[model samples]
Target: MQNLLSNLKITINEKLYVKDPETSELGRKILKNSIILIDEIGFESFTFKKLGEKIQSNESSIYRYFENKHKLLIYLSSWYWSWIEYNLVFATHNISDSLNKLCISIKIITQNIIDDKNTPHIDESILNRIIISDFSKTLLTKDVDTENKEGFFLVYKRVINRLIDMITEVNPKYPYAKSLASSIVQGALHQHYLKDHFKTITNLSDKDCLSDFYIHMIKKILS
Candidate 1:
């Protein structure tokens, strides 16, 4: 991890020393502490008071970055999606084949979901946070104050758009390229969760029966 940080031009100092302003430093500290707290204490158990004690900051300082636990959770959920976008885009950029790009994109996303170390509730938390954004309730409650209520959903929409760009060609035979790509992504993700969450009945892990199913769905859509 230290080597990776160094490679990214991040110094491996035991601590951050921006010396810019207390709020700036506190923001980083709070985020780091929140991540650790979420991992160790579970996000549901995480509290601003506890975070302040862990990071040696007051709750007021913590509120500067995130007004509440839900807002912080929103950040965490969106961060994962942003990370998925970064990794998938990077991994598929060198591949010249459109079909390969689509395959690679879905595979990377599935692998990410399966490989994440967070607890199952983290995924649930993501959906809850997205729901607030979906209905603009986060802004309605005066907790999060983004000018555009749909900012987070826009990120998801952009990901779907990128999938289209990667999957569809300049002169494609498929009449419904974008919609097909959306369906393929939706099927792969939904099937993965359905199988995992209902493992008792389905006896399927994310990709245990999913890869073949997804490929068939893709073929049917493309055909």
Candidate 2:
């Protein structure tokens, strides 16, 4: 899988950036360091000036790629979902059984992420942490509806749609496939957050992985 992914480029919404960050050395540096910086200080406290300082570039140079930090956050979120969608497709494409395919999809979506050596410019493990912690901020805004119409959240929605198709395949009669699919994706992040900061309310721990809990819950709901 790593070998397969190494050759592919993860696509994000072109509208999210003023320039393609993967196209040039400085652009790639911006992406590479932005992830590290955001992971270190978080989105609220993160700024292009800080990223410029870290990258040893002028703040104006950062703006050449992104209009502002909010757009940059949306770019990162879009890239993360696109990567997940690629992994989902590659991992489940050859599976013949619906249940097994759905189970693997759930695992891929819910399991803790690790750095993929294939993508040297991006640390997916760190990006996953950002997604778990700050992804909702991208959507819980007054601009969400307008952005939704502009297709800003298309990749994320596509991931849920893939799961919805898989759920329907497993049980064609299930009427709440869309609701369940969205819940599994969003709830995985929520559960992970709770496990990290509010442990008393969540059952997930070292002994029980998030994937196992969701898999069990999904199977029960579908049955």
Candidate 3:
């Protein structure tokens, strides 16, 4: 973990992608493994030995990147924030209108149309994985007992706030008085994703229901 963190700092400051490929590879593996580890096994059951076995690396190597389970989760959550930000970078700068930009970006990030011909829709298991190891909630609030000195939380907030800021900037008339609204929107979205049933209904198996509902909701919020 020490070497990986050092490599990250150096890479950031020095702008050298050529350095620390091993550390970089390890980081990628950790991120991928973390998705499965957290979502499938849950946090309590996840272990470095299992992670190492899954990734075909030594337990010591996994330990070298993450000191403990909490650190490992934080690392994965932080990387997830970065991943989403990186994914949306092009969308942020692509359109001139913040409304369109936000709409497009949200579609990309919280994609509807699970059976869409274009994206092939997100896998049910993968969606479960994400919800279980949620990137959004962890970024905003800490579940751990200790105060989060690590500003990885900031990185997560930046993306969410950027979206909200874009919304606020584009729609001056829209009332967004409550800071809690952001969390509300995120929580609503998560509930829609995690639950198998649509609200009180159990027979409705259509996957696009929530996606459509979210689109309508976003449109209502933006308009």
Q: Which stretches of candidate 2 lie over 4 Å from their true place?
A: none
Give the lowest summed-lDDT range of ten residues in model 2. 200-209
Q: How close to the true structure is residue 17 of candidate 2, measured as C-alpha lDDT?
A: 94
TM-score of every model?
A: 0.61, 0.98, 0.66
lDDT of 1 by residue, 1-223 (tens): 3233223321111111222122355665665556667666655577999988998777776665565676565555455555556657667767887777777777755442432333222343444223322323323455344523536444545667887776566336666767866675555555545564566555345336555555556656665
Weakest ten-residue segment in model 1 by summed lDDT: 9-18
* Candidates sorted on TM-score, descending: 2, 3, 1
> Candidate 2 has which clashing residue pairs, if any?
none
Candidate 3 backbone collisions, by pair: 1-64, 1-65
In Å, residue 57's CA in model 1 sits off its true spot by 3.1
| C-alpha RMSD between model 1 and the true structure | 7.5
Q: After superposition, how far is residue 167 of candidate 2 from its true place, in Å?
A: 0.3
**What local lDDT does model 3 show for residue 187?**
53
Clashes of each: 0, 0, 2
Superposition TM-score, candidate 1 onto the true structure: 0.61
